[model samples]
Target: MIPRYTTPEMGEVWADTTRFGRWLEIELLATEAHAALGVVPDADAVACRERAPQTDAAFVAAVSERERITDHDVAAFVDVVQAAIGAPAGSWIHYGLTSSDVVDTALCLAMRDAGRLLVSAADTLIATVTDLATTHRDTVMIGRTHGIHAEPTTFGAKAALWALQLDRDRTRLRTATETVAVCKLSGAVGTYSNVEPAVEHHVAEALGLTAVPATQVIARDRHAELLYACASTAATCELIAVELRHLQRTEVGEVLEGFKPGQKGSSAMPHKRNPISAETISGLARVVRSNLLAALQDVALWHERDISHSSVERIIVPDSTTLVHYCLQRLNRLLGGLVVNVDRMRDNLWSSRGLVFSQPVLLALVAAGRSRDDAYRIVQRNALRSWEEGVDFRQLLENDADVTLTPQQLDEAFDLARSVRNIDRVFSELHSMASR
Candidate 1:
């Protein structure tokens, strides 16, 4: 992945040094696996392990430069290791192994590390959202449907939805990574025609991977699943971000992303304090989704394998992981520093002039023996009047001729806080959360 889309740790995951290091590790492990099964000299395996690390940054750079002439990345990498070990041991370096054996296995190693990071980032985001949810669980606000206030809700309930989704997203990424973490050293075309099946299993186990029955490659479906996992996580972050953006809008200033003292929202408009971080996460999410499409296309290949998927994987794998990691990390920070106005939320909740209570009022009317349609018509008539005249809805309902309810019933109907009184029950299962 490019620096623009990558954090330093994630950048290191896709770095040349990191890439060649895994290749060398797998090559050495495979050599020992062969030796353990009496297929290769034990001395050769030891010597190769000892020398492979000596092929450092300069050596990896030279091998990368050599790739232009060979037009083979794995071969260039093998050449560097072979040269470092020399003679008889060099001969044992990549014996009975095809390019995909090293490339795919090394990719698994890198992905395993990257997956752990992504899962951790997700966990942190979930925890942060949980904290916010617990704190604001009782803070009432007007919930919207299709850009119109629909009913009363608590800000904590909204955060709880995000926290639960991110917990699932964390699990999804972890599962997808495991699916992609399998190693395949079954020689070319993956029949173990050249290398024994035991050798593949032995090497895979040593590398902390499970070898799968495969084609020339480890199959693109696993890779596709990993991409989809990242896209799903990105989509979740975007959902949270989109909501934050709406909440931060000038007309609906119920919540806001942190604004540093030196931060500037707009060059011309001094009053502008935009939701830049949320907008950025939403933009990056689109890229993650598009990458999943490319990965899905990679699932179909020419016969045993093809290079078409290889090129795409090289870009999408790291890019998708890095992008999702960034979104997760940034969202956690943004939420931690979030400025939530309890007063503003209350103001917005009542801004609809008590019409947010219409549903409860309608239901109360229906429960009192009126037909559903008749109750709805009566409620909608008063609700519309409140909308047009800015009159309180409860007052309109109280004055209606058809309304036989006493002041007590109207109090239950118009009480916005009453609607969210039981919200703490929703967080009961989340004991690790602040379930106040």
Candidate 2:
């Protein structure tokens, strides 16, 4: 990942030094495991493990520079580590291994570590949305469909829906991460070739991973699964951002992302307060989703393997992870200090002049012995009249000859509390699910 999108903790996970260091650890573990099985000398294993810590910035840079000439990163890395060790003991390093044997295994560990960070970021986003939902549980607002007011609902309900999506996203992501957290160290064409399966198991266990039988590389599907998880998470973030953008619109004005004092929304417009964070999330989500294609395309390789997936993954993995990390952090901060307009929410509920109450009115009329079609017709007639003339829909219903609803029934139909009567039970379910 580039520095611009990287956070310190996550950045370290994908750093060249950390990457090379992981490679060293994998090689050292294999040597130690091989020593136990009499595949390598005990003295050599100890020497390599003692020298493993020598992997630092200079050594990593040396490997990077060496790759410029060798054109093979894993080979370059092996050479650098062996050179640093400077002994007959270094001869045991990377024995009986192809580049993918070490590269793919090390990559799995790096991906797993980075995945945990994404999961943590997702968990934080879930908590932030939960807080907003609980805080605004009773804050009544108009609900819309097709960008038109449809009914009354609490702002908390909207927040709860977003939380639900993230919860599902996190579940799918956790599963995918586990699937990708596997090590493959079976030689050039896999099949264990010259390396023992037990040695692979021992090394994998030492790295806190599972050993999976592979063909030169751990399956590309595993890599694609992680990318799919990221794309799914990005999809969820976009859903939330889109909702925020709609609520924060200049005309709607029901909510606003936090705009610090002196924050500029525009260069020339003095009163502009844009949904910049939400818009940012929306735009970056496209980038994350697009990476899914590259990952999926990497699934098909030439024979046992090819370098096709390698170059694409080098860009997508860190970019997708870092972008998602930035998005989660940005969104959490945006919602934490969000400005919700309770008064404006109430105002917008009536912005349609009681058309939002049409369905409830229709239901009450049906309960009052009117036919369903007759009730719908009456309600639709009143709603259209209200929309065209900006008149009160209730008065139109009151004056209608076809309407069978009494005054008390009509007023009850228009009651905002009626739309939210079952909300507490819904909130109860959300809270219970979250607790688990």
Candidate 3:
């Protein structure tokens, strides 16, 4: 992912230093496990541990320099670490282990940490959206369907729906994190031909991961699931962004993204306050979704294990995680400072005259001894006139003798309160979920 859409914390999780550091940790843990099993001498394991080089810039550069010659990253890393440990103990550094043993385990560690950051950002976003929802619970607005006014709804109700989706996204992130929190040290053929199963278990436990049965590499299905979860979360962010962008449209003007004092919406236009944040989120979501396709493709590699997934993972894993983390944080800020135009919302709600209350009016006529079809025809006639001529629907109905409804009945039918009377019920459900 580019720096523009990457958070520093998430970027660091995939950094060379962090990757190499995890590799070294896995090696040391495996060495200790071997020593416990009496496969490697205790003294050699201690020397290997105590003499291991610090995984800093120097170490990373050395590994890169070695990789150029070996043309194998894991092999080069092993060579570099062996030299740093030196002598008799250095030979035991990666004994009874294949590249996947260390590489896959280290990848899991990185993913676990990166996932934590994403989940935390999602938590903050959920809170921000919930706050907005609660604050706007009674802030009435028009609901649109297919770009046409449908009925009255509160901004809070819309925000509450978003909050609920975000909550689901958070759950998905956590589930994906656990799905990938697994280590496989079954050797080149996954049969543990040389490395004992106990050694794998010890290292996995030390790293707070589970040792799972696998081939040379951990199954790509696990990776695919993680990527799918990220893509799903990104899609949720895009969902919210798209709605916000629609609300912020010039014609609508019901909501606006927060604009910093000096921020310019356009280089040429001074009167614009564009929803750039939401637009950015919607755009980045496509990238994450594309990455997920790549991950799914990775699941069908050649035979038990192959490097076909390796190069793709190097890009997709970090990019997806980083992009999602960035999107979530950006959305949080966007919602936290969102500018809701309550008066504009109210005005927009009635922009179609009284046509929004057509359904209620139709039902009222039906209750007044009219056939359902007859009631619908009566309501549609007046609703169309109100829509086309900019006349109040109720007045149009009152003037139509076939309407067959008394004034009191008409008043009860067009009541806006009836449209949102159950809004409190929705909030009650939301509050109950929050408590749990």
Could you say which candidate leads in TM-score? 3
Better of 2 and 3 by lDDT: 3
Give Cα distance to truth, residue 17, candidate 3, Å. 0.5
lDDT of 3: 0.91
Candidate 1 local Cα displacement, residue 324, angstroms: 0.3
Give candidate 1's whole-model lDDT: 0.88
Q: Tell me how far the alpha carbon of residue 427 in candidate 1 is from the true structure, in angstroms, after superposition.
A: 0.9
Give me the overall lDDT of model 2. 0.88
Pitting candidate 1 against candidate 2, the one with the higher lDDT is 2
TM-scores for all candidates?
0.96, 0.97, 0.98
lDDT of 3 at 42: 97
Q: Give Cα-based local distance difference scores for all models.
A: 0.88, 0.88, 0.91
**TM-score of predicted structure 3:** 0.98
> What is the TM-score of candidate 1?
0.96
RMSD over all Cα atoms, model 2:
1.3
